[model samples]
Target: ADVDYWSGCLAPDKLAARITPATQALVAANANGHPAAWNELRTLASQHGLLLIEDSSEAIGSTYRGRVVGSFGDCAILDFTQPGPLSCSQGALVLTDDIDLASKLRLLRNRRLSDRGSVVAGGLPVADAGIGELNAALGLAQWTRLDDILARRKAVEAHYLKVIQSFEGIKPPYVAPDVDEVHWFLSLVHLGTRFSRGSRDDIVDDLHTAGVEAAAYCLPLHRQARYFDNQRPSQDLWVTDKLADRALALPFHAHLDAEEVEFIVQTAKDASINVGAGSAIYL
Candidate 1:
């Protein structure tokens, strides 16, 4: 399921090839604030008569073809977590126009007191997924100023971009042509081919040694311990694995000022140089 090295979204062709008689729904994410190929995905879903579940948790304000990410799929989900733009401590909101599906989802999440005896259950277990009143209030309050929140994060992104451009081997943010806007979930600096996974780790270690926090962007799902299976034939995801090895995530938040941004970038550059990867960048 891991697809591209760049935007980190699903590949429609790969997804389509994997579809079988048992395939129920198609899930896609506007990963790291970059919109997925919704047009292609929509067509694939329609052709297969499958439901599309859009994951807009990291891309709350990102837009694709002028339409917001959450506005694309049959139903979408928004998370109010710390990493997300809006945080209510913790909870998620699922969006759907289907009343029946909503009702089912609500039932699955939590059985209302009024519905316990009123409705019949087929031995379904309740997850107790109800959001507390305080959390709900907080989420609603933050929702009203969502635009301002996104704008502030965008400003931080600008700072990071401006700083990273001067650092050797790293390019600015990558945005697709069709994407109208991007609201980055994290400040990312992609290491080119000249740096190996170990060198990337060395860079991160150096940053940490300098009291700067940084991290590898992600470990692909298929490579994770839980999902790794030798019996199952490996799907080709060279790009995903390679990108996972190369991508670096730095401290990113609306609170970071220009000076802090410069320090972070400079630290990364110094780290890259220490690892013998600063000059010979694989552009």
Candidate 2:
């Protein structure tokens, strides 16, 4: 299938333009737990007779329009990677209320054909992709402690928001009014327009110098060498490109204390200023 990629969580006009006759489904990530874009996307999908697939991987505890994010789409997915809310090392969950869909998913996980199709009596003909017993146990344990985990993450988010508020050139991730909650996988900050991608890298370097790990949140996938296709028409992704350049991911976890957050914020502020001043360059 030829996948039509949108540049990040899309605006209504951009999404409408991308929906060709062959577009069967619309898949989107609930970026940083904000759902305004997703909500809009859902509306467009309904209008266009497309299945809306929500990738709520990083937004396990987030809500949009009083409904949980994962519940918004026809089907939704959650990745339980180390960085995700319900970490079980590595696994993923697909959720849907449709019984047929659920049954098909179960069969797929166990590498089994549909009951109507030719079946093997002893085992599946192919390798099973089912979650192991250990991973399932870990996921269950994490699910039981989800509330506590969410609370601690929210506390850390509060600390970062408080400290980041005073920094002039840094902007915290925006939460839409309809979003009742946010489960921050990592605290993201947008460096001011005055700063370039190089300056953002400098800030990351300075944070490492201070013993705090930081990184650029994401790079445009289409711009990456591995994914770049010269045969495809060169498309403008100005918004995504600008965001990729300015966004920085800061150290974030439920275990982070107030003091650690303070240090990180201070270091980031100092680094941005130093980089802007041109005094921090070593080479």
Candidate 3:
């Protein structure tokens, strides 16, 4: 089975413009990367009878080309784990317009019609045999608050960009021209050539020592342990690997205050300088 995921900007638009008639499906994930571009890709895919799978795991409140990301594909997936805007203890969901597919997904989760052929507890099942009613209830409640959560997270991301841009060696991650909103799972700053002197690691370690937890946003999916033996040629991911090394994400949450944001920025600036200076050697 061959799959294509959209992560790079130029490539997505290019792929959307041109594809072999043999291509099967086009999959897209990542928050607010570029849905219009993906839409074009989807239309092209449909022209050739290909499936579109949208991953809105990091894009719950994000929009693409004025439509929601989850609304565009044959099937969509959303993560409910920590780091998402509406995170919970566990669970992920798939959404689709097809009733048959929905029924199949329910069956996949182990839900089945009761053999007794009678409704129990006023149309509620006596035995779940799958996801429990309580889990559904919890998710429903969380869904109700998604708007507020996304709003707060967007605000936080905006403030971060505002402050980080003022410091040297920090620039917000790439957001395509067409994206109206960003559901930032992590706020990104490029370490750039400043990393050549080792500033990136110094900044990362400084944040850790200062009680501000931060990390590299992602590793190329092809580099994971399971894929190592069968990894695609390294040249396929020139940009992805570059991002993997030089991008750093700082502590980002709704609860953080302006003072905290300032501190994080200042600390990062110091660390970047230290890395550029090299080895902290005294003259």
Candidate 4:
């Protein structure tokens, strides 16, 4: 909910404009495995004395300006969900250099209440919240093969990019010049402006009908039913809204081989063409 409240990428000037007496922290993501302007954000955060928190969940192996995604902020978080490179089945890891912050996080994760109902903890508690031995073992096994897994995923992404380049009205994901490595969790494509949200959805549905799993991924949080608040003025997230409407997430996984990628790309192209033709007819 906190993230939903302040979600879209704020420009340095826009961020400065939004600051007030109550603004104490700035939480940002290296959104969708592409590096954000973290150095600028860090400078802004420092200028305003606000803590910079990073969510590098989808960017475990990604880097910004030669430094890893999780290394820029005061504290950062990584998700080890099944979709991520380091799949622990279900868990997360927090990164921080501060010992005091680490101790506080330990307490938060494993708070033991005393008989009087006050929390008690000495050092890092051996709490139940910690990863189980079996899950730990599984995560370790996967971690050991991370290099090969990442390479496979990168290969799949490259194939998709190459195939997508030939298709009109669709573009591959953008990686900034500063982003040295991108461990893409999803092979996202952006439809041209001629494509509406309905057009994008139609293509996704067509892909589904053709046995290719694709989706109109990542709707803007402000537009979601739970996050919309009448009391608060709506943010002018024009770019966010546009991206939400056009972005399509194609099937992506390390296990997907060249043949599978070729089929998926072909299906996606066909779906886009069909949808684009239908839109023209309606016009």
lDDT of 4: 0.75
Candidate 3 per-residue C-alpha lDDT over 1-283 given as tens digits, one digit per residue, 9 for 90 to 100:
1122223433555455545777777776654333435656677667778887787777777776687778877889887777777666567788999998777676566534574475334333333334456666777797998888777877787778778876664434565666776677776666655464245666788888887787766666777877788865566566666666677778877777778888887887776776664332211
Query: Which numbered prediction scores highest in TM-score against the true structure?
Result: 1
Give the number of the best model, judged by lDDT. 1
**lDDT (10s digit) by residue, model 1, range 1-283:** 6576567889888899889999999999888899999999999999999999999998888988879878888899988887778999988988888898888788778877877677556566778797889999999998999999888888888888777878776655788888999998888778876898998998999999999989988887777766665544445877777778888999987788889999999988888887864356654
Candidates in order, TM-scores: namely 0.92, 0.86, 0.81, 0.86
Residue 222 shift from truth in candidate 1, angstroms:
0.5
Q: How far off is residue 28 in model 1, in Å?
A: 1.0
TM-score for model 4?
A: 0.86
Please identify which of the two predictions, 3 or 4, would achieve the higher lDDT against the true structure: 4
Clashing pairs in 4: none
In model 1, how large is the Cα lDDT of residue 169?
Answer: 67
**Model 3 alpha-carbon miss at residue 14, Å:** 5.6
Q: List the candidate 1 regions with Cα displacement exceeding 4 Å.
A: 115-120, 229-232
- Ranking the candidates on lDDT from highest down gives 1, 2, 4, 3
Q: Against the hidden true structure, what lDDT does model 1 obtain?
A: 0.84
Tens-place lDDT per residue, model 2, 1-283, is 1111222355667668778998999877777655536667778998999988888888888887778878977899888886667889867899999898787777677753454476556433443667889999999999999989989989999999888888775554566656677777778887777788998898899889989899998877667776665544335666777777888888888899999999999988888888875332211
Q: Which of 1 and 2 is the better model by lDDT?
A: 1
